[model samples]
Target: MSAAGIGELREGPLHAAVKDLLAVPGDRAEVRVEGFVIDLVRADGELVEIQTGGFSPLGRKLDALLDGNRMRIVFPVPAERRIIRIDDHGEVLSARRSPLKGSALDVFDRLVSFPSLIAHPNLVVEVLLCKEDHVRAPEAGRSRSGRRRRDPGERRLVEVLDSVTLDSPQACGALLPEALGAGAEAEGFTTRELAAALGVRMILAQRIAYCLRAMEVLEDAGRRGRAPLHRRA
Candidate 1:
């Protein structure tokens, strides 16, 4: 995929995931604070903001608003790799040990499954992903001092998996095909094309195809070499 295309792919899904998170029940409200549009959501009787982009500007604005009020901020995992935390002042408070587990769709599932969290009226949430150009940084000695390094084009499979919310085995068997279908269509790939398009190892694609078939979400279409096809039983 071209650089722009990769960005479009990530942004589209990231926005959907953010919308899913925001849909959690609570006194949900949005406001234009500073130069950023902030979504304020309540959880556990505490005010929180989901900070997506960066901390510099957001942290300063949030600190001013906090004014001694107990507050927390949540940011989406980096490419679904891991979640990071920030205080009202936008300082990096801590990094979550694990990425939000499950398939990308599972993230949405969790948000809906946990409706009680949305009932709170003081929380704010933000969701963001690192730009493709920032996906990897060069080693210190590899670049001039004070100059940020360019991102290598290598897409990190491990990081992507970490960032995703995987479904249970049964759920995976059930939902994998639909997710694959959506992914295929979004990427303009046919089933066979999709199996080839993952850019991951062929074995991984085959394994995912196998799981989908076992779930009855896919079936062999005569001898075309086990395409990433999906169909209802």
Candidate 2:
């Protein structure tokens, strides 16, 4: 469901910060269009949406808005994160740089929610690689892994490291590893090969393959044992 108004839309620090940075001088923020509240409507009539969460919730909103309008979905992936622990009184306890790194290809993880949307002529999926601070508050107990529990207090954007815009199926292909190649002369690759090439997990590679296949950028090239092979369509 669409938010009743801009004020009613719940956003964390990171999401709000990104929205403010993306807004242009001539753009209108929190605009109501066709019964949905658009994040930003440019002076030239382009719709911009900054989504810090999953894309599944945007399925209906995009379906309703994509017709006869240009829409850009801005998704931020934390290229680097600093973990900050906070005390009960909101005082900082400790801060450390997380070892995990994110890549532009991470967008495929979320794109799997609405893979076919990549084919829409009016839709542009913009992946913003950002450096961020992840603030956490201590929690009482931990049962699952017997580790200290922490709650997500806030996420603050530090800097926008880079951005990649997927405006067409070919643009989506750019997310694929260079080893994967493209066009009719392209070679087929399995999820294991994709994972190795991208330095990501097999699950993420699988999701990327799934999204690319749905976008028609990758087609079935037969199977390698239990795993499926994919090549450029």
Worst 10 residues of 2 by lDDT: 1-10
Q: lDDT tens string, model 2, 1-233?
A: 43535534677789889988998789988888897788889999999888888889888888898987999999999999999988889899899999999988889888999898788889999999999999988665886989867586688999999999998888988777665655433656778888887899989989988998998988998887887788878
Candidate 2 — which residues are off by over 4 angstroms? 1-9, 144-148, 181-187
96-175 in candidate 1: lDDT tens per residue? 44433323322222232222222223323322333221122323344556675543323222222223222233444443
Clashes of each: 20, 0
Best by TM-score: 2
TM-scores of the candidates in the order shown = 0.27, 0.91
Which portions of model 1 show Cα errors greater than 4 Å? Answer: 1-16, 32-37, 43-45, 79-233
Each model's lDDT: 0.40, 0.85
